[model samples]
Target: MVHFMSFLIAFSLIAVSGKASSGFLYPQFYDHSCPRAQAMVKSVVAKAVAKETRMAASLLRLLFHDCFVKGCDASLLLDSSGTITSEKRSNPNRNSARGFEVLDGIKSALEKECPQTVSCADILALAARDSTVLTGGPSWEVPLGRRDSRSASLSGSNNNIPPPNSTFQTLLTKFKLQGLDVVDLVALSGSHTIGDSRCTSFRQRLYNQSGNGQPDNTLDQSYAAQLRPRCPRSGGDQNLFVLDFVSPTKFDNAYYKNILASKGLLNSDQVLLTKNKASMELVNLYFFGGQLSTWPTT
Candidate 1:
C-alpha cells in the first residue's frame, strides 16, 4: 500500500505540471496550434483576400459586415450541410453567400497544402483578420491553430452573441463566454470602425435611445445626416457607417480614436467609451495614435 500511494502521488504531479504548462486551457479556442501555424494562417488569409476580390462588389459588402442588431454571429458561415452541425440559430446577417464561398476556397486550399492539418476555426480567425485589413482596419498578428468546433448550435449562436442594444454587462458576458477579456472585447468592437450599421439596427438607438439601451450624444452632425436618409423614422437601413472613412478596406486603429472623440456609430460602440472606465482608456490609447495591443498579436 505504501508503494502504491507513492506512485500515485508521482503520477498526479506529472499530470498537474502538464496541465499548467499547456496554458489557455479554458474556453478552448485559445488552445490550438497547427503544423505550420503561422505560415498556414498567412496563406489561408491571402486566399480569403483573393476570394473577396473575385466576388461581385455587393459580396464584399456582405463579407466584412457585422450583426449589430443581432450581434457578430458567425452563423453566416453555415450552409445547408453546415446548419445541421451548427451550435446556434442562424442570424439573417449571416446570409452573405460570398463570404462562405471565400471560406470554402480557403478550406480547400488548406486541405491540399496540409491535409487535415489545419482547423476551419483557425482559418476563420485568420481570414477575418485578412478581411478586416482588406476593408481598412489595422492588421495585427493573428494567433493560429484554433480547433474546429465539432458541432454547431444555433441556440448557442443566438444566446451567445450580443445585441446592438446590449448593456455593458451583457457585452462583457458575451466576451467572457467566448474566452475574451474585457480589453479584447473593447478592441474587437473597434472592427465596427469601418463597417456600416443599418438604420433599422440603430433606429431605436437614435429615436427611442433609452429602449435601445446605449445612448451617446456626441457624434458629428454630418455623420448623422449621411445616415438619416437610409435610417428614416419609420425604419430603413440600419447599417451605420464606420469611422475609417479613408479606407473601409483596411484595418487600423482609427475607430478607437473615433470613440475617444465621440464618433462611434453604433450605440454599443459608443457605450464602450461611456460605460466602461478601462475601455475608455483603451480607446484613448488607440485614439491618440497609440500602438496595437491585443495578444496572439492580430
Candidate 2:
C-alpha cells in the first residue's frame, strides 16, 4: 500500500499546470505542428498488437504507471544518464512493465515525419487509447501536447504504483488520490482481462499466504491447486498466468465475474469483494450489466 501522504503529493503534482500557454490539454494540440501524429501512433500500435495481442495490455499498463508517478509526463521513458535514474528499474516496473519497443518505434516514426513535434508523453497517451480500442475496448480522443520530463523518479515509481498484494482499502486509497472512485477502480481493473501476471505477483496466495504454510483461503481451492504446479513455492517466479482466465485476451467484464467467483489472480483483485461494500456493488454492477449499460467504455 502507498502512504496516504504520498497520495496527496501525487495529486498535487498532477494539479500543476503544464508549460503550454493555456496550461491544459486539448485534442488538437498537434493539428498544425504534426498532422499525422495520431495516425502514425495508431498504425504502429495496431501492427504491434496484431502481432501480439498482449502488447495492447502492456501499452495500457505502461501509460497508467507513467501517469500515476509524474502526471503522464513521459518520465518512465527516460533512460538512465548523468543525473537521471530511469523509473524502469523501480520495483513495480523492473521486469513487469513493458511495451517500450513499441513506444520507441512510434517515436522514431514521428521524428522522421516531423522532428521533435510529437512529445513522448502524448505518444504514450495515444498509444494507450489505441491499445484499448484495438483490444475491443472503447475509443476516445486523447488530449495531446504533453511535454516530456527531463528527469525520472525511481522512488516515485516504487511508491506510487499499487502492488498486487495491496489491501483493498489501500488500493482504493491510491485510486482516490488520483481522483478516481470505486467505479474507476472496477472499470480500470478490467484491463487485467487482457494482460498476464508473473508468478512472483501471486506466489503468496498459492503457498504460505499468512505464513501458515497454507494457500490463501480466499482463493478458490481448485484454482490454487491449479496454480501451484507451475508457480511452485520456491522457483518459477517469471512464469506467466493470464490475469482473467475466463477471457484472457478480451477487454470485458469477465474480470468482475471472476472476482465474484473467487477466481481473481491477485490478492489486490480479490479484496475488491471481501473488503468493502461499495466495491462489491461496483463489481456486481459490471458483472450483471447494470454498470455496463454503456459497454466498451474503457
Provide the global lDDT of candidate 2 against the true structure: 0.80
Candidate 1, residues 1-298, lDDT tens digits: the string is 2222223222322222112112232223333533454455556556546655322222323322322212223333554463364422345344322456565777777677667766554455456545544544334444333344433455655565676677778888876654556666665565554444556655665556554543336565566666666676685453445445544544456666666666566667778878877767666654564444542211
Off by over 4 Å in 1: 1-89, 96-98, 132-145, 209-221, 238-240, 289-298
Error (Å) of candidate 2 at residue 49 is 0.8
For model 1 the TM-score comes to 0.65
lDDT of 2 by residue, 1-298 (tens): 1122223223332232222222578889899989999999999999999999999989988888888786778898999999999999999999888999999999999999999789998898889878877876655667677888888999999888889999887887887776666666766766687899999999998886568887788899998889889998788999999999988887667787899999999999998888887777767765674533443221
Best by TM-score: 2
Most accurate candidate by lDDT: 2
RMSD of each: 12.1, 6.6
